[model samples]
Target: MYGPVCFLAPAGVDDPQRPSGGNRYDLELMRELGELGYPVKLTPVTGAWPRPSGADGRELSRLLEALPEGSTALWDGLIACGVPDIVQAASRRLRQVVIVHLPLADETGLDPQVARELDQAERHALHAANATVATSRWTAAQLTEHHGLPGVRVHVAPPGVCLAPSAPGTPSGGRHLLSVASLTPRKGHATLFAALGALPRELPWQLKIAGAQPDAAYAAHLHSLIAEAGLTDRVSILGPLAGAELDAAYAWADLLVHSPEKEPWGMVVQEALACGLPVYASDVGGVPEALGHAYFPGETAFERPGRLLPAGDSAAWAEALNEWMCELRLRDRLRTLAEQRQRTLPTWRSTALEVAMALGGFPSTPWHTELEAAPLATS
Candidate 1:
């Protein structure tokens, strides 16, 4: 709101325009913030390692070096997660705000070294910045638990889901089941595939998992699971279908399932709700935090949702799904709930308003009092 807003993120894909999950969130924020009449500029920087770059780290080094004095930058992506060293060298004096889309620690899961470095990097950036925002309360909690983030420093502000498609169809007897997520371990493709395999053969169902499979090992793992499950024909793993293709997939899907082990905030879950499609998801992360159990149930059937099962249990997932598949009355009710939940969340326009408010916002209550009085649990 003061100096120009610079959005810095990793450009993993060659195409400057193509952005993955974290980068996509940055783009959304940039667009919304611009609409709020704030000065915002998006820069897709090629950070060192992981992301492929022709200019390599030199491109990012030059840009960070060239940032004018006394400017404000809403640093996006995993600049803190991937390149911890840059946060100290580049962000000096600049009004830097660390936005946590996900906790870096949970991402590593097994790789403790990377996790430790990222955790420290993010903590350093958080300490250096004037302020911080966690897209979901789950992420906020994760940060506090793993990274010693000061309670007064972090606030929760969720991304908005526009009311695009007012009402979605439920997964009826002849309806389709869809899942959208990048091919990654945390996404829980293996669980979804295993559940599908466990389902009865004559269930008269087809599954389509949309999104790119960049990780070859993960892709192979999914393939092996699918083949073992005998879902070669019933399941189609189409990579990254956007535009008309994405549209058709949404329209065709009667029920959408998001089985990620942990997600800060699931864009796919929100997208499915917008399409008026009933959802079944794992109760592992911020996804349920964003879309409550009023629409998504736990253990048993939900009026608005068929059911929500625990994470990592393939048999339980399959049982819940199978039960929902047969109940036509439950399907219609679930659709109503999906549509209702979609309506409650803010649109991109209002999301900008929230961010803008945070940028220049003053304390109505004492920061310590406000945070300590109540633990944050909002999306």
Candidate 2:
């Protein structure tokens, strides 16, 4: 029998006040892996990850030292990527797998030197890992190209989405737009506001943003932009909402507007798709992959669930929003495609199985074969 898999992640992964794609992925993946009977043990670490304090580093080292020798453990890149020395030391005994959700240097608004330093640290940390798992094909490719890692060493295990009830879109044909991303520079809330500001007052659209304000300054800037654009009345900034509240936000919206400057794999994209909410997002990172091709069965002609505009381009975003708001036929077409894609979306079970296989080095185990043979269910 395969031994237990030790999964380590940030302790705040389940914090409703700090909801994020990475946190959601960690929570769902751990739960699903356990449900799949993988004998998984979760070790939630507390710290300012990717830049933990010295005390946090010592705690992590102690945890690693306590684990049985040769035990397999998967560490979230947020925790592992910034501390090469600690991880390298742990590598002597435990089998290490690091899951890179996003390259550390890809975060927006970092100083050039800080970005470079982070990039260097990440390269060292990844090299110390026995194998690396990237959450998207784009990320895996980026790691191989940017970090000089052998392509074979980095594996792809895209985040999966649970199918949600189809959103009952508004009668206004796509007037209620929703932006679900944290109030941070990387999420491009400021750029989204700029795009919305450029739209004509007669467009008859209202936006509701639902995300955590982890950065006080960025949140203030978003509010400032909203006021500057005279969108104060048209935009509602609701702080982080979880579970049914988040679901209601999706149900209440006609479209999901994602404006991230850098995203590795947008869990929100697939979540939006699962709810049958078409996404109009920046064409960066693995967003295009998450917005997978939508089409009728056996049909060669396919349509994207929504539009992909240039990242951080307010003009391009304005153009797409105008088109979505004014064109009823276009709105109908996109909605249909979104629903089609939703039906075929991958589930968390499959994602867990993929992670299991990756951790097991694609071993031909009995459970692996059984799970693979079982058809994935879509609600």
Candidate 3:
């Protein structure tokens, strides 16, 4: 039997209308833990996370104070990392663990001072936790190196992919490139537009960007950029697709293009690969790992499921995109590799089991030993 486990996260984490990688991971983990017979309790805290108001901080303090001593509580790093005092106080009584989706400081467009402050706060918060869980090995390494969290046992529990049938790729006339990510600065929509704009106008390509407009200003900027580059007819911003719409977007696309400036385990990359869609992504945090590829110091090998380009490098992106469009053989080669890789992606159950083992404090069950001893599933 496993003891009661509390999962504390921001409100609306499981809202399908506002789909996000972090939210999906949290929701799936909680559901799978319950299915695995763990007494899982999800506590949604309402506030502007990572920078909560005074009232929000007080509410969080009250929530943590109400928990009984020796309770195992898993705190989402978004809330925990920003408020070190509350987490530190709760650590004295509760057995707290932190699930860091990505380091708070790594967020794009933050002022240097604010980033430094967040970095310091996160370092302090991780130290307060009994154990820490990172969504990727790159993130775990960042926590240890950038945050100086050498003592923390940071376990890697990457998000899992739901295996899907191979997508019937785009028909022969024009290439359809799909990019699935929220319209935020970190997602690098600007760079994507710039790269596509630099490509020849005669190239047979159409871009479908499917994601929520989290930042209205950025969305407006992207629209203006597209118009300025005379790409208004070529690009479409399909907002927040889900269920059939999202599935169809994946199926209809010839290629998946993700140009995030920083991505800790790009979940969409895995999802696209699961559907046998070739990926071309930015070589950022944990993205190469998800693509089942590696980067050597001085080699430009394109033998994997997809290719990785330097983050924010519009010229490099344009060059790669041009090659992909002009070379039918290269496209077919990537598609074949993507389909072969789809068979090896991990399921949500495996991800949940790894997370359960990371949380610890469970009674000795037969699966406990197996779970603890099991290796993390490769991409």
lDDT of 1 by residue, 90-180 (tens): 6564556667787666773547776676667677666556556777777767765666665555656677765565433432533588888
Better of 1 and 3 by lDDT: 3
Index of the highest-TM-score prediction: 2
- Candidate 2 has its poorest 10 consecutive residues by lDDT at 370-379
RMSD of each: 4.8, 5.7, 5.6
lDDT of 2 by residue, 52-100 (tens): 9999999989988999988888899999998999888888887788889
Candidate ordering by TM-score (highest first): 2, 3, 1
Tell me the TM-score of model 1.
0.86
Local lDDT at 29 for model 3: 89
TM-score of each: 0.86, 0.93, 0.91
Q: Which segments of model 3 are wrong by more than 4 Å? A: 294-302, 361-379
Report the candidate with higher lDDT, 2 versus 3: 2
lDDT of 3 by residue, 136-183 (tens): 878877886776554225667788888888999765513989999999
CA-lDDT, candidates in order: 0.68, 0.84, 0.84
Clashes of each: 3, 0, 0
